[model samples]
Target: MFKTFVASALLISCASAISSFDSYKKSQKSNFTQEKSQFSDYKKAQQKAFSSYIKELEKYWKKPIMTSKKKLVSYAKDKKSRTIIDFGHNRLTIETLAKETQEAEQKLSLALVQAVTFNTEDFYNNDEFEQQLAKIEASHKIATPKIDAEPVLAPIFFKEQPTKKSLYHFVKHNITPEKIQIQKSSKIKTDKVYTLTISLPKDATIKRSFIYYEDVKREATRQQIPLALVFAIIHSESSFNPMARSYVPAYGLMQIVPRTAGIDAYYHLYKKKRLVGSSYLYNSKNNIKMGSAYLHVLYYKYLHHIKNPTSRLYCTIAAYNTGAGNVARAFVGTNDTYRAAQMINRLTPEEVYTRLLKDLRYSEAKRYLMKVRKRMKLYKKIYES
Candidate 1:
């Protein structure tokens, strides 16, 4: 549950959290109504389609189909090799049953080949599938899609032979116990449960970062933040996992929580208080933009009062993981931001960094600050020229 930055940023203490987002939205309804939403029609249609997708899920509830966001690619995992039999007494009932033969390899291979060209574009906004299925393919070096659900330069599944592995191995690190069970029972003939885990070239770190560099460069520069810093944040947050999520329920590339970071970033950009949903945040372009804007808010707004520029950055970085209040307490023993800045002005940048590393309340925040800082240098040395 990392990247609770904005949720923690505005609060004075854990006892006093952000006011109910509903209350905030009601107050800003006038300004919100004035803003033209570009995706209203599309989201409406998507909502209708989701109703159908949910019904479709009833047919595969026991062996739910996990898939890439839109490219329709999938990493098919089955447990016939291990737990082939169990309590049929608590049997999962579905609207339909698997038409695939009882043969495990045939069941797996057929679904794999069919998924090679299948696109889940219609079901891209399906959160249940997105969370469990895991996003495997990221778009190539292209413009972020104009439509939130569309993918730009998305390679067809199984098209690239550069890198791949079995689905079981690829997902072991990220899968939940429930997901593990679903993978075992999946044998639906037409469900497009692919076995081959199609992935981008992870042979080099740059290869992964390059996939989203165009968008990162644009947003970082537009926000007047360092390009390397943004790159480093993405690197540290999810290791370039586009579908990354945290139990904090943060979503997409930056692990942005809709209620907190998303709301803050949207308000900063549009001057309207609104709750951004996971579907919108799942779009890599939107995620990076919001994350960069959040970072901009941290540096230029929350931590802006510190006299030393470098000191401001260290605090900003720490505050990006913890909160401005936490960082404030680290220096001044009180959660008063203005007082913290006053104390920070009296010390050198080194003093500020040392204090954060040594005294920040959360170990995660200290480690997070160090990781992002180190990755910033790595990104600078290797990619920034």
Candidate 2:
């Protein structure tokens, strides 16, 4: 009877253990199913959001076609608004407006290029030449001597007799012309006014429209970036104005924020010990160089694992406007700080781009990417042509 009781106890214990194991497995399966459902819902929401955004953007691009006269008048009153409206007025479509703007921009760019490229000899004339000579004289402290008296003859005594000598007396009286020294007045030092004439190949209005083409190209080449991409960035950033300053207090054509991207690029590429200040970015070349280098760093250092070149380029462009940290967050679908290398291993380039478009926190970054990509095509077309 005791033996029978032991067998029964062992069977009960084994039965309870199997039951617990089955319950654990069911709980695990239920949790996985719930997680899968949540992920599916999240993906659907993301798709919806992306779709709505694209539709809204399409509406904006198609805006001019349906723009009312009242709206045009309202836009026309503001100088800044009028320029955009005027470009679209004739085209009656966004494409035409873009083309019109591109053409106008190209004309202005060409005029500027010609102005900087043409030799200054064409502007040289007697008046300009004389002015330059005067400048040189003033700079060197050169002055002409003033002659106060005419040549005069004086009487000289030879032995015992006093005799009158003509002006030629220099030879007869042993008086040398060198002995009669002309008095030279001290140089009349005047404030030197430097006048520089910049002759534009076209009107001043057009020349002012495009000032920093060469600097953009030079820095773009030095950074090994596409010239069109640089131009697109400048077009989006500050429209190629070297003196541009943003509300963030970013400076120059590429709109560099010296404390952040500027310092990062300076240290990364230049390997400098000290950080360059904001004033340095006010220079057009410095701004472009730093901005482009920063973009390159984002592409290679942060987004390097993205296999698709175009996708990588787009992300890099967005990162330039936003920040790489935000980009990494978008990639991993997490707001929490995470490593890009770890996340990149799990995602394809297209997946990264889609995730960025759907998940990026900033609307401005989204708009920036679209505008830059659109403008890049325009720049390449206009530039090559």
Q: The CA-based lDDT of model 1 is what?
A: 0.59
TM per model?
0.60, 0.44
What range of 10 consecutive residues in model 2 has the weakest lDDT sum? Answer: 148-157
- Residue 152, candidate 2: how far off, in angstroms? 62
Model 1 scores a TM of 0.60
In terms of lDDT, model 2 sits at 0.49
- Among the numbered candidates, top TM-score falls to 1
lDDT of each: 0.59, 0.49
Looking at model 1, residue 322 earns an lDDT score of 80
- TM-score of model 2 relative to the true fold? 0.44
Residue 123 alpha-carbon offset, candidate 1, angstroms = 8.3
Model 1 lDDT tens row, 111-153 = 4333322222423433443432222111111112322433212
